[model samples]
Target: MLIRVLFAVLVVVSLVLGYVGLAEYLATSAQYAHRPLDLLYYDLQLFVINSAPVSNGGPYPWPLEVSRFLTPAVTAYAVVEAARLLFASEIARLRARRRARHIIVCGDSLAARTLASHLDAEHRVVRVESARSPAPLIAAGLPRAARLYACADETAANIATVLAASQVERKVHAPLEIHAHVSDPELGDALRDRGWREGLEVDFFSLDGVAAKQVIAAEQPDGERLVVIGLSAFGRALLLELARRRTEPVEVTVVDPDGEAVVAELAARHPFFAVACHVSVVPVYQPEPGVHLVFVCHDDEERALRDGLNAAATVDATRGTVIVRMAELAGVGEMMVQHGQEDRLRFVGVLDMASVYLSERITDSLARAVHRRYVRAQRALGQDVRSNPSLVDWDDLPDTLRDANRASAGDIERKLELVGCRLVPSLEAAAFTFEPEEVERLAVAEHERWVAERRADGWRYGSRRDNERKLHPDLRPWSDLGEAERQKDRNVVLALPEILADAGYRIVRR
Candidate 1:
């Protein structure tokens, strides 16, 4: 009789527990169901407990004595029912996202992964075809393109997958962006011929005749660093010249405020940029020559840059120190000439807005032209070169800065905001703690490389003789090349080392 009673109790407990779970499951999908159980230690109660004690026991707790028969079947039914209700929509949601918008990437490289992760998740993506993956760089940036040209991967097979999966004809985006070789030189082009407008973006994956110039150094060496600060919008072009002309570097730092990332990235995996780049806050104080370049943003920024540099730089006239100021920047280039002559330092003014505006690669070619002109102009000038003022007295900097600020102390940030000079803060570092030597050397090496390569190629110098005359120390050695040259190269990438001469920065080269 005791055994029979225990068995009956067990049956009653199962019926009650199963009923409760079903009620909770029914009201909402099991995905949405949650609540507290009756007991403290037993709050989790996966199974039911018999609350009735010895006082007056009920034979069975369930409404029907036959509920025991259905207990075993209830467990399986409730579990599956809850899971289906909970996850059915979730599965459908993912599939829908994949419908027309999803992009299936195929490379297993680190760069590919990083680019994918940083992109917006809503931009559906999948790595469906990566086995012995063909190059996929061309297709990677399409989803980010500003204009039209996106792949038309309807419900059929994915354009990325088909091209990568050996079913090349099925790839809707005609030109498959293969990070590696596409194997067939004609394949990328053939797809376009066959009505698919797919083509290489040229920043990356354009193996043949890609205008391949934006290299890092001569011999096109790898891993050299470049930090360029252009005073105008032309800085963007300067970056392209460096990358295409030099060899790949470990890393290149481009100080540009535009959206040049696509160009920077595809050409070299190691390229970095200092966004919103501007000239130094102070004038190139005691502008010297060598690896460092101190440039003012405009004629207005000139005094600010000059005052800042003069205040910060050291000066020594006996050593022939000179700080060159570029007045051609705006209409105020004569500021360098006036300061140089008054200070009795080596000061020479150039009619050279063109040289200042040349792209790094293009300017690299201007050396022969520069050398020839300076040589010719020097002989014709009856005045002495020694009379040039190369160094700006360090003691004079405080007053100079204060005075320049008084005249026009505005920075480049406010002016170019419309042309998207928002990246100025990159140059306007809150705490500029870098040792000048390292950054200077890096910039000079890059400039020399850029200049040297152009010299080798033999570029055209428009007015070599005319520039030589104005570059001379007789006050205006290269006056003819002014402002016209300003629109040529953007700004001087090579800062004057302590080699400031009266010819703007002659003393700095020492």
Candidate 2:
């Protein structure tokens, strides 16, 4: 940007100098006496290196001499810049080789674009046309990149891209963090379950999953009675997130023409869906009284907006909020506000949500910090990475494990709400603490939340810990847990102040 500005300034300066120089030369010359317009025309020709200087066997005026050289230099620069633009990809590749710890985003998909946009402000972002192409990946400085995101439109393409990146990492013997976007829920789960290669650090994310988290965070809906008017991927994700956050089962009414099949598919994939939420399928949209929240998640933005507006009109302002899924913000919310529906209508854009997700995950966010704290605690108890798979660093942790940590971190707000407390940005570390009774109550709530999460993940109570069978004795109710197990939850409650403080937040009683 600065270079462009300087180039512009130089171009203008050369033009002005040429004009003034010509005017001065024409005024002082004895052999030539041209009109002002003629002089201006001659000055303009200097840029193409065809200007005739008005000199009668004597040295040209200083201004003319200066302009004569400056004009050609500016012309040369313009030529070079045009060539640079023509080969921008090659130039970017060459420049990328000199950059280290930069972010490399492959593909032109919306997810990739959003991630690049968010990271470019804080980090050097190198974009490549293809994720699976070795040439482009190498040109993008894959070996030098701090992180590589394979966000091609197709899941197979993204997978191939990451695999190619892994080969690059192996050849260079450099550690690279690889993130792949898997849109298919079942495929994503299967990949996560199969796990990445032992030595590679690969993370997978779904667009719907990230957007669902954003929607929930934005709305902060109570889990009393919710209506989801489309059992789309995003809708299912939202339900899963809600279940993960709430200890008690939420009553959700899914309104979709094919709600039965969609709900059945989700239930088959995740048995915990049935255990965590009391969901009822309905064929069509119906305005239900006493609903806490409603989400219009149709893939088509126009349909979503129309349905959302209708839902907003029927839903009582004081009772529920209606959310619409949009690809981008196009002033529909403002129009709703003009119609006096601002309090009830909200829009969640996919790009916006993806941007937030990338920003948080790419940095040392609160979620990563929570995982780090958990790892440290596990290590303090004499657990090693080999002995406990979850004892790995944030980068190496599986996506599911990472999601669990994120869910736990995300639940902080709900836990605060339980005790009439709230989190606000704070400058002081360890500046707040909960009372003894509050700690006990919160600890119990945390335990219940943990139980619900475990149950939702298909874990069951057993006499001993078994990761293979997904069984743990502590999976039972909080009351049934031993004092030692209860203390683990209490310790997390006790660490709330410091953890929140580290994330620049402080808990305050409402």
Candidate 3:
């Protein structure tokens, strides 16, 4: 009511001023020279008040005359407000560019909100564009994203824009990989296809869907590494089990939250051959049984493995016991039969078979599905036919290199016998290379390392425990040193390797 009355007063004042102006204009300047100009600006301002220009234009400077003709004083104040609002909006655009979070999302609003909610835990989100506010997305846990703009609506285009916004926001330091959520299966597939096109990997699975078979299959022969990603616990355990039982290697990268522990443990236990700059290459599985030895070398393959890419260099002085380092293995249980004597080969690895089945959801069938898919892709490429260069090309190397390579090759073929991993044509190198003596040496070295590490760990723990004991005089018993007990577990590290070495298997380094 107060605003309405003030508005009426402004109108009366404007009308009175107009009447005076009209008389003055008629008396002096013919019909007021500025009337036509002011009227044009007023009409344009009235029509385009909400339709603001990117560069210029705003509401009236003489708003009193244009609005209600309240008074010249009122008109001056209105003009100031219009100018201030216009500049303020421009500033908003600049600030948003600097600070806004950009999230590229797909699916219906609900799905977007769901995905947004998940992403919002760690990031701010920009709602691309829509009539309604993205409050649902914000509610779902997504950060507030007020400045929404898009160059295009296509998936690829949207990704580009999101990247742009990310750069503008300087998100590269604290990186956030794009998270896509598509509710519809068909749309999900489409999005995935586009993701690959954009050089991104996408993992997907229904919470309920399950595969049934578990056997690893033969491949067509593309020599490229086959990687299985986004595996569930069941899949990871299955894969790890297959690798454990195999004689060769299979590359696996599990992206499930539950599976990370398995991967970490595997990493800790596995013998790693190469610690290159960016690639922390660790072979996931080795076809050989009773041997998980990773050899580190300054140059040339360690004595256990011949040298270079020459598979021959991989042979151990002790013929039956084989060591594979920096290797991944698959298809071992059945392959073990080909080796002829189970007692001949000793299998040892950083692998814990229990880890394979640790995940409740992991199943043999999913593992087979992942492996079979790779085999199918390879077969489609016609990589088989002895042309699988991983075998022949390395096999065809000059005899000087090929001898050690041949020995290495024998080691691998022999390895298949150990684990029954037959599909992998013996690669002679890490396949069957490892000297038990060298492995023992590696193990001994490892034991020393464990001893040192454990000692250090013991000291660290002892200090803490002793400090606590000092704090509580009553609980501190003569031998009631819990810290000392904790330190004892450090010796557990060297125990396993020693037991394996004592078993008479060669424990070679990669």
Superior candidate under TM-score, 1 versus 2: 2
- Top candidate on lDDT is 2
Q: Please report the TM-score between candidate 1 and the true structure.
A: 0.23
Which stretches of candidate 1 lie above 4 Å from their native place?
1-59, 62-98, 108-110, 133-166, 171-290, 293-510
Worst 10 residues of 1 by lDDT: 501-510
List, residue by residue over 396-459, the lDDT tens digit for candidate 1. 1333333332222122122223233221101011212223443443333333443443344443
**Candidate 3, residues 1-510: lDDT per residue as tens digits?**
785578668646565544444333333444334465553343333223321211143232343234333344455666776798789855644554455224444333433443345545544554444312333233322232322222222444444433443333222222222333222222433444443322222332211011101222222112223232223333333344344334444443332334455555545554331121011223332223222221221111142123112221232323322221111121252244256533332221111221121121112212222233333445777876365423332212333333432332233223323333332211112213333443334333333443444344332333343532332222232245355543333333223222222211222432
For 287-339, candidate 2 gives per-residue lDDT tens digits of 87788788888877788888988898888668788888776443666577667
lDDT of 2 at 176: 57
Residue 454 in candidate 1, Cα distance off native in Å = 31
Best by TM-score: 2
Model 2 scores worst on lDDT over the 10 consecutive residues at: 168-177
User: Against the true structure, candidate 1 has what lDDT?
Assistant: 0.31
Better of 2 and 3 by TM-score: 2
- Higher-lDDT candidate among 1 and 2? 2
Candidate 3: TM-score?
0.24
